[model samples]
Target: MANSANALPETGFLRLPQIVGNPHANPPIPAIVPVCRSAWWLGVREGRYPKPVKLGPRTTAWRIEDIRALIASL
Candidate 1:
């Protein structure tokens, strides 16, 4: 899954878990944008982060461009 994130070709959406990232203890530690689900929702409500798009009744995601912009701003 981490590889898939790094492998994204150009543009797409990313689910919350993917955005937060996975942790590994081995060599070449992956970059993790760690944020708890509640804190993320709070950021959304406070406009500190991009609003997510509802892909279905129980699915939500944010645009890759928006996530990149947020990372750049930080």
Candidate 2:
């Protein structure tokens, strides 16, 4: 999972396992993309990073808020 903007390393915060682990606790990119693709086709998928929302022209991003909330709910 892509780290939240608040969790970026350039923010000068400690790189602890717990915090980083929070996002990766789900799965890495290798496992996530396949499901994300399927979810994109199914319309029931959620929590995909870097492809959250569709911007105009040619852009996309995973709504960080959605992924975080989904994680929290889980």
TM-score of each: 0.72, 0.36
Cα deviation of 61, candidate 1, in Å: 0.6
> What range of 10 consecutive residues in model 1 has the weakest lDDT sum?
24-33
Off by over 4 Å in 1: 1-8, 22-31
lDDT of 2 by residue, 1-74 (tens): 33343353332222122222334455532332224444443543442322344565565444545444544443
Minimal lDDT window, size 10, model 2 = 11-20
- The best candidate by lDDT is 1
Model 1: per-residue lDDT, tens digit, 1-74? 44444555458888886676546534433443567768888999999999999999999999887777777667
**Candidate 2 CA-lDDT value:** 0.38
